[model samples]
Target: MPTGVAIRDPREQLFNAAERVLLRDGPSALTSRAVTTEAGCAKGVLHRHFTDFDAFLAELVRDRIARLDATALLTSAGSGVVSHHLTVALTDLFGSVAVAIVSLVISRDELRARLRRTTPTGIPLLTEAAAMLGSYLAVERELGRIDAGCDLHVLATTLIGAAHMLFADRTGTPPDGTAVRRVVDSVIVGALSTPPR
Candidate 1:
């Protein structure tokens, strides 16, 4: 009963459906039949778009990672201390996105290869996050809000990794907000503190 205008790009629709399935029931529920059924399309529609179920899953994961990177880019622009923005930004990154990544990483060899191929060799997300943290600290130092002469890059990496572990809770709910704030602020202060040389 679907006409050209009524029908969306099946590939796009399929990917969106897969994301919902992933968020709801996790990745194991993402078979071609399940995706097609969820998308309300023919089962053959999957194959018509992706090479196989694994390829489709890998593409889904790739699309998510790209979206996360785009989010970090737009959100980080003109943002303040990693304390405020980092937690929420990282909540998005290390939260659902990280879970999806771990799922794909644990899947079959070809899927793993596809993920690796889609991802750049280095983890630019971490690097960019750290750079952003450094910039924030550098600005604070200039403003007399904090002392300087600190290695912002190193501190940024530490904060990024720490944020991942701290906030990537398996439980649906996040941990205490104030506690997270203290941890992030402490790390920033400790790293950027102006100490006598």
Candidate 2:
């Protein structure tokens, strides 16, 4: 890299590089050098864009969280099988770099603290996931798909936790769709007022 080579969207490039590093070599291999090298930019590029490496990581997680398609989930409330939608969502989320991102968050205290400033609650990815699922469940409840008195918060948490466990097994390939659907069905069974369609 040259001294004055302008890199378009350095932040995104750096974030993508970090994601590649995190996904390929795990959190332990991720560093300012690793990210900059992967981005094909100078180390100063990262420092100039972010307050620090942790700041970069925090922004990465936030970027990923922002990418989750809440609108699709929300709009699916009145139509498709709830479990099916959740199954696809969970599978897509964990199948990507999300599980690795979760690991990265857990490995770095500074990143966690920085994220806490914005996410002030549970783990970033999982917390937002639960909220997404919870929002979908709330819509379902209104549509009479689930029991009127169902506790959506609890249901959403259960679904996310259970689904996360199924996909967190990075030791092997992510669980197949059937496996995810099973977890979804088991967790949401008690609350369903109407049969899954």
Candidate 3:
């Protein structure tokens, strides 16, 4: 057993266990039984906490999105090289756990509908990411790092779309940090105007 697993709230324990199962065995293996088994709790524990498996999954997805939002909040522009900051933020956002959760949600319609009903705005994670990226780019533009003429929304959307593909390419291992940085640099440079020579 892990250090904190035994002490945390039951909901958190279940969530963490579900994430572990998803990451270790992929989305198909993330059943209520698997989650409870990994959590070292009874099968009925999840039912007692959440309305059903879909409800639990919905809450888990929302919790993960909230965590990603918190991470985005830490990525302020002008604090570091904008491309590097953006790369790090995107990499964290598209991590293997996130990818697994997304895959599960896409394959499970009941969970998807549950999530849509529970979230206030019903906006998906990718849209939220794009919005965060756009805000970061706007701040960078104000600091003169990005071109004034560049459309922040379009650039953010493009970056998010590319990142989606990069993350979805689970053919073998994920793209390394160097590859992610190169892609971020290319995107940023293409969107920025040449400085005065």
Supply the TM-score for candidate 2. Answer: 0.95
Highest TM-score against the true fold, candidate? 2
Q: Whose TM-score is higher: candidate 1's or candidate 2's?
A: 2
Write model 1 residue lDDT over 1-197, tens digit each, in one string: 75423446887899888777766667666678888878888877889878888888777766655554444433543445545665565555665556555554565566777666645443434444556556665665566545456676776687777776675454456556666666667677665344211
Can you tell me which runs of candidate 3 are displaced by over 4 Å?
A: 1-8, 69-76, 118-123, 169-171, 193-197
Q: Cα lDDT of all candidates, in order? A: 0.63, 0.89, 0.77
Ranked by lDDT from best down, the candidates are: 2, 3, 1
Worst 10 residues of 3 by lDDT: 117-126
Question: What's the ranking of the predictions by TM-score, best on top?
Answer: 2, 3, 1
Q: Which candidate would rank higher by TM-score, 2 or 3?
A: 2
TM-scores, in order shown? 0.67, 0.95, 0.83
